[model samples]
Target: MSSRRRLLTASSCLIVLLAVGGTVVAQMEAGDRGILPIDSTGTLEIDGIHVDVGGKDAASARYAGWRIAQREGFKKLWAKQHGRPESEAPNLSDSVLDGLVSSIVVDRENIGPTRYIADLGILFDRARAGELLGMSGEVRRSAPMLLVPVMISGGTATTVEIKNPWQRAWAQFRTSQSPVDYVRISGMGVDPLLVNAAQTGRPGRGWWRNIIDLYGAADILVAEVSVQRLYPGGPAYARFVGRHGPDGEILGGFDLKAKDSADIPRMMAEGVQRMDELFTRALAAGELVRDPTLITVEPPPPVEDELAAIQPVAQVPLSGIQIQILTRDDAGLNNAVAQLRTIPGMEGVGVRGGDKGWSILFVNFRGNNVTLASAIRARGWTVSDVNGTLRVVPALQIPGAPSGQ
Candidate 1:
């Protein structure tokens, strides 16, 4: 099941109090999204550790190599949690995770009489590993966020629609020790295709909220990674810059230098790690706050459920209600029109008029003004009935830079 669906199940009877009203609200984080999850429920994979063994026989040599791998695996986990790392690791004479090592695969190997050399992958029991790391097993994680991985390569920019290697890299990004909770929304359909590189720089609460709603996320994070290579075969350099909504952007970017194409994975991993650090610091400093406007209400309850009885049936009959909507761009305009048609009483949407900065939409809705307004709100939009006339804002994610430092 999706994380959002799981969240709804747990919060079935709970209420989301209005938080944007200046009250000190704590972000209720769920699921695991840390660089090194303090308390992992899934398998803990440790890779790239080298082992060398010299024994009296090939059988003894293999046994010795396996022992070294188990010890080394625990050491890597320790160093990850403690960034400084220790030269001498504590002896694991009686670790609970001793017999819990699920699997060990050789990455690269060379063998000779009475000797063995290999790089290894060790899988440890996640729960036990957390205990060994001395973690409380309760690290607060960030909200589920939609990541728009923008790739600038070969003198051109590639978004989700373009199908580039950079996008694939992000798709395959493993959050082994990362703090960022990335919600990998697919780039299918027209909406994703419409998003371009220029959109990342722009922002509007309405547009962002709409986009966030579409992907069932609470926020948006833009990871702009530009990759470069000197010639036919040279080291590749990846520069990562990140910004998030609603309004905390890191000013500078860090560069990841890779040995070659084979190192792209490492570069991407490093980039995510560094980006996670910036966000973690920001979150701790109280600079990163969740947007209350983006928090969606619970989905409609099932017909067979008792909770459905409490739902209001504020249906309004056809009344030929006409309204005017102002949109920032054609994209928003189309999005607004599509959403408007989803309303029960909304009959049709016609273009009354339009221009560069704004457009006029005639909403042929059948419902009462109040019902129509509530429908818009449920869709993460704000509508107004002014002097018996309606001014509607469509629920769509548009792009623009807000007055954020």
Candidate 2:
């Protein structure tokens, strides 16, 4: 072959090799770490410290990897496809890198950069892996849009109060921290009356349906229906009840009783507290997955110096005082003495030269007065009542200044 042609061919081969190598490296780097798109039906399991995909035994490693890639890719693609600005889709190379780390840990054949390998082929417990990841099991699910409904039911007074106390209680739920798209309150005032009347074939069945429709379905329901209203005596009381749900199926429930109106708030608070506790427990138990949006981080505001706004000022009393100013800047020293001469007392002021940029002031407090001493100290100035002679100095004066002398 001609030398020219040979050189061209060699260069072409080099280019091809570089391209292929880059593609492989990119693929390898993209593996393992990511927010895997978990199946709504899939269960999560932990074998030791590793989280394994559960639910379907047929889910292969390659399938899992593809799912992760598709999920990560779709997030990018969705933004672009929807004509989102480039800034919105700025390359998420870090997220892809995290996926790579996770893949290495989960992949059985090639345990790449992960700290340890996990066998995910069989049933893996999500709760166990969540503990390892320092994440609640609910956080493992990829759906940012899904809402888990929780129901609250208790005494009518506790649940029916217009204040919606259970709403505050629901706020205490750990999963409640997750984005809740909808909150439905049942057994609250008219809703319960309407619900019970509807159940009894009363005239308000349609009205109850409208009420349900108006409030929508709750991801969590807190019902504080007065199982029994309190009377003057004789053990009258109310009960607080709470329930969690997905598509209206109650995941869990709790109940507590209140003997008085004062006990209502206490019981409500406890009910809400318990609801939160139970929600966290349910997440740990693999019963609920958290919304991904809740994991989103907000950028912090810029920091400002705390002292930037304040200017330092010093004040000293000149009552019957003879002052002396010593400074390298003779003009500044004279100005300071001039200012001191204007004070109420008939004291005279004088400036004298000192080392570096320091100055000294001497004052004779015609009488040994504590008020003058305190007034000088109040201005953030140093005052020394030495033998009834008041010496004033700036608080931040240089170390060798004669103020302390």
| RMSD (CA, Å), each prediction | 28.1, 26.5
* Clashes per model (N, Cα, C within 3 A): 11, 52
Q: What C-alpha lDDT values do all the predictions have? A: 0.64, 0.39
* Candidate 1 per-residue lDDT over residues 1-405, each given as its tens digit: 101111111112365665667875543321122111123235566767788899998878877887888787878867766764656556675244455565565656667789988777676656656676766655677777777777898887766655655555565444545555677644555435434565666656667677777667777777788889986567998888877665536534788888877666657755765776776676677755776766666778667867765788775566655566766678777877887888877787788776554566666677677888888888877578876556765545365522111
Clashes of 1: 11
Give per-residue CA lDDT, model 2, range 309-335, as digits (tens). Answer: 567656454455433333447666765
Measured against the true structure, the TM-scores of the candidates, in listed sequence, are 0.52, 0.24
Q: Worst ten-residue run, lDDT, model 1?
A: 1-10
lDDT of 2: 0.39
Question: Cα lDDT of model 1 overall?
Answer: 0.64
Q: What is residue 389's positional error in candidate 2, in angstroms?
A: 99
